[model samples]
Target chain A: MSMLLLVRKETVSTRYKVVVCRDLGPDVMPLLRGKPELELVVWPEDRACDRRWLLENIHGAAGVIVMLTDKVSGSSLQVVSTMSVGYEHVDVNAVAKRGLKLGYTPDVLTDAVADLSVMLALMAGRNGGIGISVVQKGQWTEYPWAPFGFCGPQLSTTAASPTRKIGFIGFGRIAQATLARLVPFGITHCLYSSNPSSAPSSERDAQLAQKYNLQSVKRVDIDEVARESDVLFILAPGGSGTYHVVNETLLRKMKPTSILVNASRGTLVDSDALAKALREGWIWGAGIDVVEGEPQVSVDHPLVKEPKCVIVPHIASATLETRRDMATRAAQNLIAAILGGQMPAQVDLRGFA
Target chain B: MSMLLLVRKETVSTRYKVVVCRDLGPDVMPLLRGKPELELVVWPEDRACDRRWLLENIHGAAGVIVMLTDKVSGSSLQVVSTMSVGYEHVDVNAVAKRGLKLGYTPDVLTDAVADLSVMLALMAGRNGGIGISVVQKGQWTEYPWAPFGFCGPQLSTTAASPTRKIGFIGFGRIAQATLARLVPFGITHCLYSSNPSSAPSSERDAQLAQKYNLQSVKRVDIDEVARESDVLFILAPGGSGTYHVVNETLLRKMKPTSILVNASRGTLVDSDALAKALREGWIWGAGIDVVEGEPQVSVDHPLVKEPKCVIVPHIASATLETRRDMATRAAQNLIAAILGGQMPAQVDLRGFA
Candidate 1:
């Protein structure tokens, strides 16, 4: 037959596909539905997806929705718009090399994380961990009121401030939210030390300081951040760039009555160093949200065993309203990116230092 | 005269004789030693002296130091002065009728009480009680993550107006102290309900409010008091007249997110009603220093069982420094009153309603 006489075969339009590695709960499904053109394959398995399974099922995928348990590799990043702020699980270099857009839910969870930061601060500051243990172990009855019994360092906005100052290791979004919460509890000044290279503009710093009516808000050197703070918050980003920022040297520089709160990354802190600091009274107490190797940490962990340390499982962004908003926004971001429109909310991949 | 001198000479030369019902601990005894001439007779038991035993041994007492447990009755007002702020055990009306100068430690312990009030408020508002319970019960590991888990309210200062509403059930010295502590916490408006007859002049209120930069400080009716408070502190004096002032009707008027803190007296609140309110969410949470029938409260108590209610055994004035100060001041007050000079710090035994 002649070439012009032959009829061209019908070509099917390729749909944008996503692999939800593990099944999302009932609340998350409606958000992904009603987009007739997108294809979503739910694994329906509650366990972590095997590497082979993820690679096989992720063919021609432009999106990969994942929970904290998923291990997304370079091979799986054929196309993926992640649904989380911490994209450590996903192969970032691969995504960059493939020229694929990445999406993450960040600012939406700041308020919830901030709320939790304050919560841990209060709990640890008040000696709540030990106090409740006393109650549970039926010890309160035996030791009703021994003078100087069971009292922890109060987060005195006034008493602690005259000599002990408030400082932060990383002055980021959650740290700012925590400062906002602490202002009502009587914090007048805040000194912070972010990475020197990540230093924000003076105008933005001034705005933040004025916004909170802080006496002074400035980025200082790491040593100054330690020496001045009565309540030092560890809220830096994770990864090799900022690991072990609050080690023994920085901890030893703090006041004996100071409290340290970490609602940020796990690897950013040295737990063994923190334990020694707490035991030796280098710092009065510490409230840690992320341990060195969380999810594998046991009751016998040194940080958990330390009486002065308050260890909360990583739950800074776990409020009901906030989580829902995060999931919904994340889904929206993926859909918008695939639909050839602007994301309602998008994470700045370039901003991760 | 030397042939037949049989008159018994009273030990009037020992002007500094003191009888303490209980042993003042290491922190307090040093303050007492400041007055070297003063002789202190502590009870051997070091707990509490029986009323009859005290009456017999209190013959030559220049100062009678009593604890919350001792009952110094109308019959036992032979001492020159009684020492303590809460003289309910001392029978202060009888002391005045018997012409014994009554002294009390008031302003000295204001800061401690105020610090405790804010502490209780923060603890209750942040759900420290519940969180502590969870961590102690080993529930933290059992249920690691959930959407609506461990969420509590937060207090943040707004930039436009840096203030949160702070209300007191009664406006007294302790109430004023509590208010002072709250000022640094961004409290701008203070509402209170005092005894209608003992209400201070508007000018006095205005002056005090201006000193603290509070926008409005006024004595309001109980209904209005309950309706507008973000934190309603029960700091009123306790007696039959003020019993159950914060009952169901008043609690219902409070906001659903409001926090109730009682470092004042147990009788000021209706415990049964408070338990019901907490369970029903009439108010968000409560922190109680004094329970209705405290020291007798068991784990099965209704308020104790309620997740939102944090019951602290009355330790508002329990700081090491403050307690020592109080004890020393109490001793001074008793000594000053006994010597017939003007009592340094005397509580006017007027209508205590």
Candidate 2:
């Protein structure tokens, strides 16, 4: 009877299956493999996992790991883990309703995203794209460096102008991290707008200001953020509520010399309006990582065609180290959930559940 | 007799002829124009003043303000000022022998250059050039986001791996400014190589390390710098001693994951050797602002053709504020020297004089 019980336990443990949407690379694959009891059904491809393949393979899976391209539906899975910070593609409501735990990699990408945001701002402010194009297009020798040649607004402050104000649409982790980076650039003031329901924290603002040696950090209305910012960063969460938040009205209100940087959701910004702003000189320039309808953006995209706009296709967190960490975390979450252990970074779906 | 003395005073004041190589823009033109007594001779065209034109126009000038494109020969001028930090194009020996004051705009551009240095580092580490090229080539939509797609090394550190070593070829004002920017990225250690004749600054290094919350900030040999650095910056002056300082030997010594950035002088790094390093994966990538024989870089240039290299025409100080300040300071130096007053930023040429 005891021997039969051991056999039964082995059968139960070996029956557990987990599905991985795509290859998580060598660095992260070992975690899933280490769990001998949990079988990993990985999509063997260099590209994003096929939707048909994912749906077919994920049928009896106890836990599944996904990327932005993979869609999750209401299933009998115990857990779902995504290898990205943003889970807009994932159906969180479906996962919650089915009593499935959700995991995501967030903090690992904060620094990488923050670094890229500052890079974009500096690139826009210094006209880096246009300057580089001149060299690439073999026009450098012909166009002599004039006093104002390729010159845009400065990112840092000078002794002559000691004050620089920075603004943010959403003062979240990424925004705060970006603010920290800009502090050395001699940014004197900061203005941010959070959800209207959120309470204002003057003490926290004062502490942040003092820590960064800034003049002030205040929470303001969206209009004030648009008007006062020398460099405005759009870092709000993406959804219907934030759609077109920075439309024509807000773009028109911004200082003509101020720079606009959107490292957040694309839907938050009206790309047509921004392109028009660049064309009409309503604003100095813009740097966008994500567009309204991205991955679908073509060469003829209005923002891409704008001479003053610098656009990169949604690569704010495309750093090897961060991606590796995120992949590892996602794998760990899957492995832990299947083994009935606590997941490393499970998203709290308590509200939906 | 009183009227004759008044006419003589007017003639003496108006006799001060100043030659400007190009338009100094509104910010600085007004400064020179404010002194109505100084007669201004500016090159009419927007391009770099022709060699013959500058020579002819500078003949009787009491002072001359030049750009990097303008060559200043020894003349019977009171002062020679360059609107750039580097005055290599100007013949200092000739200026000194003629007992003329030399002035340049330096400190004003420190912040701009430093900001660009960080931007270049991030760009190189993140494969910014290749990523943008992919989008511009209309391959972005076709290529779905993979788990490890377009991923490059991270510039910032994580708690799990908290140490990041930064190396500098020359630890000067700009290097220090760059170091300040990297502190928030959690740089643990720094290595630098300086002139062998200079004394070691252990005390100063200790203070800097402590202030920046670093483990160590020590001067080391070039080989050690290559071996120890995760990100190495070439910030030394460009000349014979530093030419090809980071050549094949040094390139081979660098870690395969390391990144090299040259924002100083192009001559300091060997382009062919760097291209080979990147091609062979000896080093991760390179971000170069200035290239050898710049303003002449073609599409066929080895470094330009390198897939991992990010090259920009030398525009490190090409920000509106910095350029404006530089032009103003250059003008001020010329105006002061011509009027026999103390120039604000005169280069001490007393030794040569």
Candidate 3:
């Protein structure tokens, strides 16, 4: 038995190499460091991982943990773990072609993202961005507090009002979670547009409606979504297929009182068109979490300059608990893949293949 | 009979006088103007109603509709209708002593205020205010996006974590509505401190726990609220009894990770104490809708200068639908009082008396 164990130990890789693109905080870094069997190679800086450093270090890595900023395309990696729900930066096809497993943090961030989505919807509808700006700019004192001075559209429905229609660009986990939150606000109708390939399920829609006490929950086309939504959320996956899906045409169809929220990806919206729409009163206002060129968004950015647009940096999943959970998951994924165990959240890359 | 009818017609006032502090809005002005029996007397300016103008115009008015700025103390006014839920600015004793009906817009603004409360909570928890400020200040181009740079506390709970405890200073309609919105975020425990004179109902607590699928819902002392709360909301009515209730002592007792939200009157919290607490990291952060002497909150205000404090002018009920509803209710209240009918939302001042 001693000889057999010795032979097995010799057969297994003595020092498994794992590359971490960014420094996940104390709560998660210790998990990777405590492992004696793994040899860790980290980016060392507090900023985004340098592309050159990643490319150089990832050559012989068995596993790699990356953030949205890192592009993972090397074939040597056996597993690619991303610390976010969206994996648009990574080349899934290249990783999958090499039979590499992809791990991502998804369910852990659903609550955080969903909370912000609802918040953005409320802020946009109520002109909260401008309200805060006015106070911070020292104009609140001079501004007259009239009965209807700062009024914007409401997000909730009341007994005196008709049923409010809420629409979603993508009907996925985050959108569903947001809908669940809106139920208490007397939201009764829900409409969503998803990939046409996804078979429409009326039974599921009915179940959701009954569960949430909503009047109707239907899968609709993009035009119907724009036309009916009092507050529309763009929760679609970011990619070329969804790029500029909500442009001039869709913005024109929306009600003047409607509020548009982009919590998913900025690429799904046209910044120039949205600015034009807001300027021309095509829509009441907008609240955006991500922009097409974020971190690069300056004062000159059209969306940033739009008074009616409430643009926040990409901090939708910036809650401490959620980020810690994401880091923990990413570390665990790397550890599991190195030890020949099933990962907690492995992305199915068969579709990409 | 003809002589008697003519005598009655001559004795009864032909036109009922209503003094409006400000032009309510297009949606609401029509309701008052369309009435044939009521003669409207409105403040001529597009700003806050002038005290002198209000006093002069309200001398012999049968009803007066007011905003928070207007003082409704004249004896000749039979009804004082305010376009807000809070009546702290009004002299309730004087109105009640004169056998006057005090009408307020309550339920109409509940959803709007509740929505803003939740938005503030999320914004505070996620560092949304600072996040936006960073981008707006042109610091985003230079600031590196780290894995955990902009992270703050999470407002939700998950299976992997312990249940989030939500505490309310005053658990009234707005607080309850805010709680209803948080149910889906996996909140399993609730604590609240209301007026000590109010009887605690164990049965109601149990029912609320069961209805929301919460582990427990209990009324506790302020000390317990400070100690156990993960996210504490100041939703109590502002007055002498509640003023500075959450002072330095209470704030010191709160957990460093706890988030404080004040959507109620600013007097309920000691702004100086809260600023110190936030600066010293006694609590995670705070989100305040109403501040002490608001509209007067200057750029150098302590709370405004605190990086962790997310301050917004008192726009909690600034939604167009809510304002319209409030205007409609205020107009209706005046019309009802003048026509010798019960007001839709008349304040019962017996407790105060």
Best by TM-score: 2
DockQ of 2: 0.67
**Interface RMSD after interface superposition, model 1:** 5.0
Task: Report lDDT (Cα) of residue B319, candidate 2.
Answer: 84
Tens digit per residue, CA lDDT, model 3, A106-155: 88888888888888888888788888888888788876557887788877
TM-score of each: 0.77, 0.95, 0.94
TM-score of the second chain in each model? 0.84, 0.94, 0.94
Q: iRMS for all predictions?
A: 5.0, 1.3, 1.3
Q: What's the lDDT for residue B95 in model 2?
A: 83
Best by lDDT: 3
For candidate 2, lDDT tens digit of each residue in B1-353? 35544444344435688899989887779898878678899999888889898888888788899988788663568889989877667777778888888899888999989999998898888887777677666667876777777778788898667779999999988999999988888789999999787789989999999998899999999999999999999988786768899999999999998999999988899889999999999999998888888778888888878879887778888888888889989998998887768788988887764
User: Residue B340 error for model 3, in Å?
Assistant: 0.6
Could you tell which candidate, 1 or 3, scores higher by lDDT? 3
Highest DockQ against the true fold, candidate:
2
For candidate 2, the lDDT comes to: 0.85
TM-score of 3: 0.94
For model 1, which pairs clash?
none
Off by over 4 Å in 3: A1-13, A351-353, B1-13, B351-353
lDDT of 3 by residue, B116-147 (tens): 88889888888888887887776776655567
